[model samples]
Target: MEGDNIEKNRWACRHVLPLYASLGMADEVERIWKVCEYDPRLEECTAAIEAWGKLKKIEEAEAVFDKLEKKLRSPSVKLYSILLKVYAQHKMLAKGKDLVIRMAESGCAIGPLTWDALVKLYIDAGEVEKADSILQRAAEKKSGKPMFSSYVALMDQYAKRGDIHNAEKMFHRMRQVGYASRFRQYESLIQAYINAKAPAYGFRERMKADNLFPNKSMSAQLDQVNAFKKTALSDLLD
Candidate 1:
């Protein structure tokens, strides 16, 4: 009878947990977790943390992480990264930094996910330079490129600050890392140029080369850029 209950709980963790989490039923998730007799899998624990994150329940997320650590005796790097991501989402810079340090001391491999989480933590904390510095250091290592979202995060921040040069630099670097240029990245670069009140020269052609057509929002932005360029040209002609 006990064995049968454990098997049912394992199945519930695999299937029911994610479904409840996605539905924003945090209470139900907690209830299911409490009733489980077997040790939860890493993915199951991650799902609980993510559920709390989506609801912006930082303490709840941390509690789940604590439980995972107690159960496993040593959680995996991915588990640590997911918890770090929850901290990042809530802009808990100090906590995130401390977690990263603990991860290093525990010899958890700082793979792309951990690097990405660290970058995001700094970015959300309004420390763009620090985030970019981490990104550069990560790139110097042989761990391949940081995650695509890391590049996009810096690009979005640079755009928000009207720092067109760095935004463009990030875009190019993202491409150099072999990440296919996507609409979100293109939109961010275009927004950078728009915020700087500068023309995004050859952007349309570049998008064409990537086989990406402008959507409604992007088309509106491009029109503004064209108007700015035309005004500048007319002023020069006069």
Candidate 2:
């Protein structure tokens, strides 16, 4: 062992790199990665992909993705979606879009989570029009499929954007598609309506149409909600 050259230890380095990563020694893992004769295989790539994502080293994960050949990149739609979600979690919207295109080019079925992620990223980026466009595309692409998450994300996006009419329209469409509105979505729309003061008539009509009302106890809850929302808004302004 005293006469061992650095080159002679490369083989051992390859075997121990993953162990280092597993032990949370990211810097050591990177050091070994740079010096080791690491062969890029699907299993290794997959493990690196997962490890980098878990560590929130998104750029490093993207680097691993770049090393993989297209043929061995993602053998199934599920894995592709998993990686896309990882990109979305990093707020890498452009990368997510490119991955979606790649999944489509490979003839993979787009799952609800992928669509939901796209919609959310667009919304978070304040690209409401683009988000709407994506929803339209999703409607066409997955016709006859129930996508409750997608619909809910879109509705939340519109509500957050203060597009109550469009949000209401989508809410109706969701009901038509047999999706019951969640309480969060309902509260979001209600809060948006109240904040904007755009038209209480429509809000009142819709609430009545949906058989929802502010009873005495619910009015108390609404008062507290309004107070909290006002405080939050004030804090943001301050």
Candidate 3:
């Protein structure tokens, strides 16, 4: 069992836990995971956790985390972040937030990327105010660059609520932080304006170039928006 080829196989196995998750082979993944737990390598544990998370096996992933506590000296921040990400993926925002706080209290520095995951989850949940609070807290930190993507997300949320003032604030923040104002960002705001029956700048050309013909529902919505405006399709095109 302790031969060179066996050694090579073991080393190779160390790398495949992530692969199993990517390939979505949950049973094969668990088989490899059990072997890693018995042998107990740090990299293996990390990979196993990630594999489980990717497969959306949150309970199994948490089980591995629980099992590893006795064997590893202390888990790395990367490992904890992965676990937080699993919670977020499952829409368990409160659980994810609690994990971050616990990890911080235990002196593990959960970074901005970790916070961003929770912000995304809150946004998906339509809890825009909560997402804003999380972004504000993360910004208050001394470290990390400005999260431009967070502002874009906030812009989308504000647009959904038809809060143009707040959406504009986020758009300015994105500009201040040097984020390229992407087309989807514009679409969200335009959609908000259309829904609110308000005048939206650059509406027609953006729609035509966006190749939005496939969506019948959206096309009908656009017709309604078009009715209120004085400008024609040609005007928008021009």
Candidate 4:
């Protein structure tokens, strides 16, 4: 074999390093990134950084981020969002929160994913009050539509704590946003009453007055209601 052709590493690194990094081949990623950094293309560097973040390799991701041209890295909103997502998933709450403040200060439009990450971080940190406050701001803030998951997530925390009053309050807030369906209130409202070991007749009557049809998903709640009813009857029998 007397071939004398050589393939340049630039093209291969630009196109394939991200894939290798994503597939968890850290060594190959480092090798390719070393060559690719000489050219400093935004697309390639972004891919490499994203791959590192996807793999949860914080140091590697940071290295790629640093290797990006200063201008290429400075105003990149997508890159910030990606990094914030990784930060949230990895429990790097402080960094994620700092990035959020920075994004807001820089006027980089915060999207739903970033907001979701912040809320999740608060919830996971046992700062349910903060999470609720964020949901409140989301509802009241003119910047973006309130995320339904935010509402449900806060309601979940309240329900878990057997907080019927706040859970009902959240139900009212959800209704104010036109999420007044009977189904939406089951986990958010009825479950609170059930967990609190309190009768839900008032809520049932309210639903009846609202003319909520008994959808199929209501069957289990109906069964729960009947079970509670039998317990009451048995108590009176005693």
Candidate 5:
């Protein structure tokens, strides 16, 4: 064991804490904390905050954050987001929103991940418009490059609400953005049609038109379906 105190603390923070935290070994973290100094002024604070988050030690998280704020004028966006996620995990939506406000006041721009967590909170609370607004803001802040996930969530919500028009609109808008289309989005659109009591034939046709179908077998299936449509359903059976 090296007698260097700073190196030992750094090693423990960088390596030991994360490992123990992943394994849910809070006792090991505490053992290391007792033997070595825990520096609140550096990135090492992340390990402790994350460890506390894993353990649901909200008070401990607050203590580390207070120390970090006292030592360094403001915590990093990453730190704020990490703690916010922890609060969200605990269903502390009020506290999580409060922290986002505080993080903004501290001059850290709310990034996509931070907005995603807050959007999740709004969605879970049945605040669709609120979540939609947050996602719009997230899109605006990210230079009009909305995360694919944002569209997926909105489509899911619209489908659940049976708002087929809006769901289709979102799908089209995502394509207009020139983002590479994903099969999941196509599947969601089809499901939305089904939810709205609309025939999904148009969507299946569009999926083929967009070249978004998954495999060659789907093409064969589509051919057979199209041929069957040319013949009356009763005639095909006869």
Candidate 6:
């Protein structure tokens, strides 16, 4: 009977924790975690850590991570990725770097999730070059492509810098990886052209091909691009 009760508690931890966490009920999550013999499975621990992360409770999340680490033989890459995401969310660059080193020292297989988290950490730290370098390395590896959001993050940064060349590169590379272009991606690319003071010629047609209609803000930006093109033409004629 004791064993059965323990099993039931474990099951509850797995299912109930994330639901409560998502609803921002951290107290209930903590209570449920404590009831699970403190031997919760990876999913439960992940949920608890994510819950604490959402609440900006870094130490609490770290405590959960430390506890989870003690129960596993080989360190779990997914667990490390989750914690790294928390660090990224809070812009804790130093702690995130240390965690990456720890993952390497522990011989954790760096997978897609880990790569995505690392990229996000660098991006959030305003280290776009480092993030791009990591993204390139991930692409060169056999593990997998970095997540779609990683590509978009770099694209957004490049757009901000008026880096049309690299922004377009990221956009094309994103498509080369078989990820379909979305409205946000197009927005980033168009913003790059706008920032660079270049006309996004035929972009409307391109959007038509992709079946995307611009929102009001994008329409205004496109008008600005057209005005720039006309001004450039006037300069050439002068």
Q: Name the top TM-score candidate.
A: 1
For model 1, state the Cα shift of residue 52 in Å.
2.5
Residue 130 of model 5: what lDDT?
Answer: 83
lDDT of candidate 3 at residue 62, scale 0 to 100: 85
Better of 2 and 4 by TM-score: 4
Residue 19 error, candidate 2, Å: 17
Writing each residue's lDDT as its tens digit, candidate 5 over 45-159 gives 7677777778878887777777777777877777887777778667777888899889889998777667767776677667778878877666666434656776788788887
Question: What TM-score does structure 2 among the candidates reach?
Answer: 0.60
Expressed as tens digits, the lDDT of each residue in 1-238 for candidate 6 is: 1244644546666667667777888787777778753566788788888888887889988988888787885669999999999999999999999999989888998878998999999999999999999998898888877899889989999999999999999988888877898898999999899899988889889898999999999899999899889989999999
TM-score of 5: 0.69
TM-score of each: 0.86, 0.60, 0.69, 0.65, 0.69, 0.83
Pairwise TM-score winner, candidates 2 and 5: 5
lDDT of 1 at 130: 99
lDDT, residue 105, candidate 3: 74
**What lDDT would each prediction earn against the true structure?**
0.85, 0.64, 0.70, 0.71, 0.69, 0.86
The regions of model 3 sitting more than 4 angstroms off are: 1-19, 22-24, 39-43, 67-74, 160-163, 194-197, 202-228, 231-238
Per-residue alpha-carbon lDDT of candidate 1 for residues 150-207, written as tens digits (9 for 90 to 100): 9999999999988999998999888787899999999999989899888878889999
What residue pairs clash in candidate 2, if any at all? none
lDDT of 1 at 199: 80
- Note the clash tally of each candidate: 0, 0, 0, 0, 0, 0
Local error of candidate 2 at 64, Å? 5.6
Sort the candidates on lDDT, descending order: 6, 1, 4, 3, 5, 2
Clashing pairs in 4: none
Better of 3 and 5 by lDDT: 3
Better of 4 and 5 by TM-score: 5
* TM-score, predicted candidate 4 vs. hidden true structure: 0.65
